[model samples]
Target: MNKKGYSRSFISLWIGEIVSEFGGAAGGIVNGLLLYEITGSKEWMGALWLIYFLPSLALQGISSPFLNHVIKEKMLKNIQLIRSGAYLLPLLGYLSGEDYITIIGLIILQCLLGLVQPIYASLSFSLLPDLCTEKELVQANSLLDGTLRLMSFIAPGITSLLLIFSPIYVIYIISSLMFLLSYISLLQIPQNSVEKIATWSKKFWWEELKAGYFTFFQYPHLLKLTILSSIVQFAVGATMVINVPFIRGELNGQAWEYAVFSVTFPVGYAIGMLLLTKLPKNNLLMYSGLIGGGLSFVLLYFVPTLPLAWACELIGGILFPLFNAQSAAYFQREAPRERLSQLSSIRLLFLRLTMPLGILFASVSFLGINTRLTYLLIGTFIVLPGLYFLIKTIINRDSSAKHIRNIV
Candidate 1:
């Protein structure tokens, strides 16, 4: 364990995660840029994402049972290595100077990334409890979450700078190197940090898969958290689809203004990570974060100016980490240790499934909902439930207080 009370393994994992996230973010941006540069078709871009998301979600659904059967640390390292090689495909195609080959490479790369990400994420999440003491898990989660968000925030700017001096394909090489570095960082973790479950059968695989979902539903608190997280993801998906139109069209904002609006949330998220360490970790803070973030979305519906829109995103960014990191820690702590990997995969499947739903909700204009109204609807979806839970929490506390007073 380190001086901060985290195991060296955890620190290594954190470092690896940070590097990989930066690479992923930078590569994601360049993927779109390079694809658009080659094909110049919005439909193809959308199709490319579909190729990634459809298979990724499918794999996430069926892959949970396998997680509990594997060594998480090794799996994570292997994923990073695969990602490193996957990133090189586009660069290789570009070197060959064939647009079709480059496109094919990008498609293949996305497919590979899509398949591995769910497994990687599930393994890393399950490994977290092993990487730190129970007392240190929240802070560990916060640190990991914060730095990853920071990397996402930083990658775009750095990628843009790189683009100014080199071909776009060069970014892919850098991304590949980043993943290789991540793999090396992960290698420093002790091999025994995770133990694979010793059981295997075709029948057992089916049973474990069913058990993952069954066990998840058997825990109401975990289910509730997953649902809430899913709703947030749904809102996020909608925001992705509508933010451009609402900012540039409705608000008549410039490109720079829109960029600022896009960035404020992650910036606030980094700040929120710091703020969480100073605040008490409790249901109140967690629920309040959810409600506050929801309110930010609601406020976007009312904002008359571009700055207010930016403020809304910034406020949401600042508040969301409060709920996210704590809830994640809570889930990790509450989950049965042996089944945690399977359960983590189950939890992630639900979360991943919601984003595309939100995107569809926003994108389908036949619903006849305007952009602001969609914002209002998404915010309300979050806020009303949040308010319900918050009120229930307060009432429960009061009832307990009265009972205590009577007993005294």
Candidate 2:
């Protein structure tokens, strides 16, 4: 498909992503705030996210094989519609008057959202190629990424303002509406030709699932990259549980201050996106991103004030895009298009699988730790993987040099 430009389809998807990012970001704040208001425990927070992560990752692994047969845009639209519906569950729960029932409702809502997110994400990822050319792929991805981050950055400020005028539940309503808008925007995407896939037997479905896993193993480099990325995901999961508590409990901050702290990272991320395209593309730079990003969190752990913590988040955000954008581009370029959807799901499965573990790690009260220490621990986990790979590359380079010298 010699697609000449960013056609209506890609543009539509781009707009949808923008709206969706803001919606998701705002809703994330509401979730944390709402849960904390009710339970006041980091353990519940961890469990909340675990509910999201466990099924989300499990389904990503389970559903990879069938994605190829699915019509990407239609699947995407359905997911958005479902997401919009899911946001209402919490709002409905709150209105029902029973505290226990509200918590259970939120849990069920998270479970359903988790079930659908990977399907939407993976389909959208694999659909991009059909919408644009190789030259445009990186640019397209960068635009989508930067916009998402920028929206996330902007959403916090908006959320902070909204909180002044409205109750927390209103955010869920807004989020639901945003997803509806995203669905409406996506409706503008031009329909593309899709190949009909025959239904395989139960045994064949199992075979396809195995083949998807085997493909990841077959491409050792992809597997390696996915593992390295997962380290950061694990840390992010921990951070998700700790960041709010670290600000509120340890730093003695308010919702506004936490909002500022959250915005700083994505602001840096937006700036980082600008730099990502200008910098030289290499594995070293990408690896450095993991190290740099991890180091930011480590710095956050030691920060004595909100301003310093905000700075750490900003720097981390800036550092991450260097890795995130380039790694995504590499995968899109390398993965076989026919199997790309399957492989991308497998990749996402790897990335998202450890997040729940990280949450558990952070929430382990029996470990006798604080949020600051949790930050340090997870940051170290992220850095160590990159450090290992960097050292391995150096060792292999020196070994090759010695072999050539001996041959000469």
Candidate 3:
């Protein structure tokens, strides 16, 4: 263990994730840019995303049971190597000097990426318990989550700078190299620390899949936490569709102002990560974070100025990690060791499924929802439920205290 209280394995895993995340983020930026540059049609851009999400979601649904039966460290390393190879396809297509080949390569790249991400995410999440003590989980999760958010924020700026000096296809090479670096970093983790499950059986796969969902439903708190996270995801999806219109069109903001608006939430989230380390990880902080974040969204609907909108996002960012890091730690600490990977996959699937729904909710024209109204609706969606849970927690605490007094 290091002086920072994290095991060497966890640190290795964390470092690998940081490298890979930056690569993935940078690649995502170029994917959109290159595709739009080629087609010059919004419809084609949307179709490209659909290609990624549809198969991705399909795999997320059926892949939970597989997670239970594999070695996580090995799978994670494999995924990185696979991703490194996948990034090369687009570069290969570009060198052929054919737009059609480039498009096909993009389609295949997205499909491959979509297939592996859920597995990688669920395995890493479930593997955390083995790599760190239960006590270290919250801080460990905070560090990982914070850095990921930081990477997403940093990668775009770095990619933009790289574009000035290099060809767009060169970013793909950089992404491929980054994933290779991540694979090498992950190799430092001792294979003995990760438990190997019995070989998976095709005949029993359906049964295991059903059992995974059944076990997930067996825990009400787990269900509740997952739903809470989904609501957040839903809010995120809606914001993605509407935030540009809200900031640039409605508020008459410049491109730089909108960029500031985009980044403030993540910057605040980074600050919140530091705050989480000092605060007690209890129901009070968790529920308050949820409630506060929801309120920030609610405030966005009422903000008249661009600065106020930025503040709302910053506030949401600062408050969300309080709930996020702790809730994730709670899940990892509470889920059964044997089924953690399976359950983590199921939990992830639910969370992944909600964002698209949010996007649809915001995008559908007949819904008669305006930009501000969309904010209000999704914000209310979170706030009402957050309040119910927070009140329930308070009541449950009081009831337990009273029962203890009667026993005394």
Q: Could you report the Cα RMSD, in angstroms, for every candidate shown? A: 1.8, 4.5, 1.8
Question: Model 3 reaches what TM-score against the true structure?
Answer: 0.96
lDDT by residue for model 3 (74-134), tens: 9999999999999999888888989998989888989999899999999999999899988
Per-candidate Cα lDDT values, in order, are 0.90, 0.83, 0.90
Clashing pairs in 1: none
Listed in order, each prediction's TM-score against the native is 0.95, 0.80, 0.96
- Tens-digit lDDT track for model 2 on 1-408? 234558788999999998988888898889888888888999999899889877887777778889877778888998899889888888888888777877887898789888988988888888888887776666677778878878866887799899999998899999999999999999998667485575778887899899888877988787888887888888887887888888998999999899888788878888887787677766778888888998998887789998889889999988988777767877887888878888999888877778767877787841688888888877888788878877887788789999999999
Query: What digit string (tens of lDDT, one per residue) describes model 1 on residues 76-140?
Result: 88999999999999999888999999999999999999999999988899888887887677777
Give the poorly placed runs of model 1, Cα more than 4 Å off: 1-5, 193-199, 365-367
Sort order, TM-score high to low: 3, 1, 2
Ranking by lDDT: 3, 1, 2
Candidate 2: stretches off by over 4 Å: 1-7, 26-54, 85-109, 163-173, 244-258, 300-306, 369-376, 391-408
Whole-model alpha-carbon lDDT for candidate 1 = 0.90
Candidate 3: give the clashing pairs.
none
Residue 225 in model 3: lDDT: 94
- Please list the residue runs of candidate 3 whose C-alpha ends up more than 4 Å from where it truly belongs after superposition: 1-4, 193-202, 365-367
